[model samples]
Target: MKRTEAEQFTRRLTHHGEGPVWLGHHGLAVLDMLAGDVVLIDDSGAETRREHLGAVVAALRPRRDGGFVAGLERGFCLLNDRFTVTETVTCWTSPDVRMNEGACDPQGRFWCGSMAYDLTPGAGALWHLDPTGAAVQAIAGIGCSNGLAWTRDGTRGYYVDSLTGRVDILELRPDGAIANRRPFVDVTGEGFPDGIAVDQADGVWLAMFGSGLLLHFDRTGRRDAEIAVPVRQVTACTFAGPDYSELYITTSRYGLTDPEAAAGAVFRARPDVGGFAPYAFSG
Candidate 1:
């Protein structure tokens, strides 16, 4: 497939912008991971407001309760309508570890992985927290756990451990857990893969940071298409347009110089195929 170029959608800058998600009327919400902020942006790309959690807001999803389930610096949080921390559950105690990218399964169980601030190899692991509040270790020995997306039918899951240089797939057991881990596709990019999304056709669109591209992988794990952006730090991507044909990408200006004007802006693109609407956290 030919490489598609993206256009700037919004001009909001993020030190480490990540985790873009669409919640219909909610417009778009993204994490300024290092800034410990979750900012809401309208369709016009205006920053509506931001919630400062005093801790890194790594990833989050809308909850059936009308709030959100989120991964924070040292634990998971349940926020109410006012964006107040109604509940906070600590996973591990060390400040060295921080939450990374995460997404909810069809059953409403939220899964997010963690990594060391120093990026210590094998110092991170993926964790699953169900609505019942039972947290389990899904995968161990990971470095820089970055992205997680599930298939439409919820039988399979995809993950990116940026350090591994490949996207991995796991069989989602009936219990809303994962197993049988294996490599899905190997990738060569400038800064490894970041966040990812699955289309209605199960096509995987991955953000390749430092490479200024979003690479597309088909169900068979073959590189089929790619998108070129203006900046090197393409952090994450999601589908949120009218018919879900518009792909929204999040980027960062962290450690960047002579950067493209749109480096920290949200970029928009139209793919031939639309995407699957993500399920909210039913918990």
Candidate 2:
């Protein structure tokens, strides 16, 4: 496999940096997850703004109409273009679990998974929120639910329940429901899979937490390339730049007593292929 190193894009900016989304001219948006902050960075790797939503901001995706849809600590919220919270919905009353990671489908539906704060097994679930402001439990019995991505066509989805140590493939129905699911990649001994992004060429770039590496898997699940990051807690990644050729990565300083200077910093790499823009939530 071809190997490369990602260059540091900025100084350590987050304690537990996660979800990364590339917004064309608007630059990049990432989360200081545990801090409940939405961080906006310019194309030049400069932090331009930071907006706190609640006790935790797990994930976020742009909206088709405008603004954004985000997964908060125990529920979901909508934000206007100005980063102001417009509405909020509590999915459940359970205070033990929190939203973790998610992505919007091509059909404008936002899907996010949850996990227990203490990492309790099977204490979380996958949720679906349609454009009409309706929330439904898509899947239950999940543990450490993380990384989610869908194919451009919306027919397939790649998901990670980190505790499984594998990435699973989901057969998505026309209505944004999962028709079937099966294992797609087994990273059993490599490291824990955290976040993922799919390229236009059907390549899945997965961030391996604690391994300091990003593994690229082709359409057939064959390892093709590797991007080495400076921090061990590599969290998430996304395609950015005008043409979406730039791969932006996020790292974390969580659970580290003495982390590297670059921990919690963002990094960038030039992959062979670009990626599609993030699917916006129709609502």
Cα RMSD for predicted model 2: 0.9
> For candidate 2, lDDT tens digit of each residue in 147-241?
99988777689999999999999887887778999999999989999999999977799999999999999989999999999889998999887
Clashing pairs in 1: none
- Model 2 spans > 4 angstroms off: none
**Which candidate number maximizes lDDT?**
2
User: Residue by residue across 218-271, what tens digits does model 1's lDDT show?
Assistant: 999888899998888899999885677889899988887667777778888998
Candidate 2 local lDDT, residue 63 = 92
List the candidate 1 regions with Cα displacement exceeding 4 Å: none
